[model samples]
Target: MLAAVFHENGGPEVIRVEEMDAPRPGPAEVRIRVEASSMNHLDLWMRRGLPIEIPMPHIGGSDIVGTVEKCGAGTVRSLLGKRVVVDPSLDYDWYRLARLRGYDGEPFRVIGEHTQGGFAEFAVVPAANVVELPDGFPAETAAAAALAGVTAWRGLMTRGGLRKGDRVLITGASGGVSAMAVQFANEAGAEVFAVTSGSENVRHVRGLGADHVFDRTTTDWGREIHRITNKRGVDLCLDSVGEAIWPQLLRALAVRGRLVSFGATTGPAAKVDIRLLFWRQLSILGSTMGTPAEFRDAMDMVFRGKITPPIHAVLPLHEARRAHEMLEAGEVFGKLVLDPREARP
Candidate 1:
């Protein structure tokens, strides 16, 4: 077996493809022959080194679509030979208790960030994490949808309280999660506003059902949305860009409106105006990945064809370094997939 891994973190160039021993499933786990895996911004963060400890020579990928090749002790035998997509959000005992109590648990950390992930010929996960894929479904598409789709669904519907006829604003609309947020909000009958880095991304974001697309390079999107909505502002705003645009998002929200954020791609520090927060009576909510129920609901819509995330490119596993470069440079509009079967001999 071969895996794309980095012994030490710094940049994309640190990632390399090397022959490695295949992983085996543990009790209650299943081994997946990874067909396709997708990249998330988390990958970039991990590669650049976060504060958490990582296993040396770590493989970083969270969104995985694969076939069950073997089942380990106490695993359900029926899952063997099935094609499935793994929910990258690992669950814990306290998480279930928190969900039952209607609170968000400090979630078990993400797969690739804290555990070995799917950038390999084979990976192991708890069998309970696998979601069966319908026959003939494109594995690459499922892989692309796994993390971003779930994150958007939870951010907008669960945290943002998005509903039909709501006016929604999504910042950094060209990335995977933000693009999915646009489509999901649109399908829910919201009037969707989007912000992108340039004219090229504006066109792409518009194609994803954004009612209006503003180029961040030239437009003050907050003011534009404010004017467009006749000073009422948007009912909801979903932001992933973090510090770079948080202040603007505050100005773009309607009175008592909610802003749900899942990531801080542009660095975490942000300056907030205390007056605007109190005067508007706004809700600024933080969200990470979805709860188990939310994950199921989101993937159900995905597997049923209600939403399909765009795939910017499908590269071989050996090109993982180049893929990371593209993602880090903000050159991709959607998910970049890796086919482990394409690894060199």
Candidate 2:
């Protein structure tokens, strides 16, 4: 097997494709012959190194679409040879209890970040994480949607309490998660407002169902959103770029509004005015990936064709290093995929 392996983290240059032993399934796990894998900002963060050390010589790709080749003991035999999409979220006993009670859980890790992932010919994952792909669904599309789709669904619908006729604002609209957020918010009957960094992305976000798109580079998007909404403000704001845009999100919320933060791509620290929060009766929420149930719900909608996760580009698996470069450069507008089956000529 050949995989994109990084022994030490610093930059994209650290990754290289090399022959490696294929992983085998463990009890209640299955080995997937990876057909496609997609990149997330998480991958970039993992490669650049985080506070917690990952396994040396790591393979990073959380969004995976593949076929079940073998199942280990205690797994159902029927799953063999079935096409599947992995639910990247890993659950622990604490997370299970928290999810059942509808409260925040201890921070959970994802497939690519905490364990070996799918940037290779074969990867092993818990059987429970493998959801069978619907008939005729494209593998590339499924891989692209897995992580971003679940994140958006949980942040907007589950945490933000989005509803019909409500006005929702989605920041970082050009990114994979936000692109999906625009569609999911709109499908929930909300009037979607999107924030993108440049004019080039305005139309892209609009095409994904945003009612209005603001150029973050040119205007005060928060004020623009307020003016466009006639000063009422939006019912919900789904934002991932923290610190740099957190204050603006606060200013854009209506009375009794909800704001869900999924990631802090910029940085997490934010100074807040307690007075505004109380006076407006606003709710500030934090969400990460999602629960198993949430993953299933999100995937059900995706496989049913209710929403589409946009794909920015697809390259051969060996080009994983370049894919990281593109993502780090902020040139990718949506999910970027790697086709493990495409060999260089």
What lDDT does candidate 1 reach at residue 325? Answer: 97
Q: Count the backbone clashes (under 3 Å) in each candidate.
A: 0, 0
How close to the true structure is residue 186 of candidate 1, measured as C-alpha lDDT?
A: 93
lDDT of the structure predicted as candidate 2:
0.90
In the range 29-52, model 1's lDDT, one tens digit per residue, is 999999999999989999999988
lDDT of each: 0.90, 0.90
Query: Per-residue lDDT of 1-345 in model 2, one digit per residue for the tens?
Result: 889889998999999998899988999999999999999999999999999978779999998899999999999999999999999988744566776876675557789888899899889999999999988789988999999999999998888888999999999999999999999988888999999988779988988999999999998888888899999999999989999988888889999999899999999898787888999999999977787888889889888898988899888998999999999999999889998887342
Query: How does residue 148 of candidate 1 score in lDDT?
Result: 94
Off by over 4 Å in 1: 92-107
Worst 10 residues of 2 by lDDT: 90-99
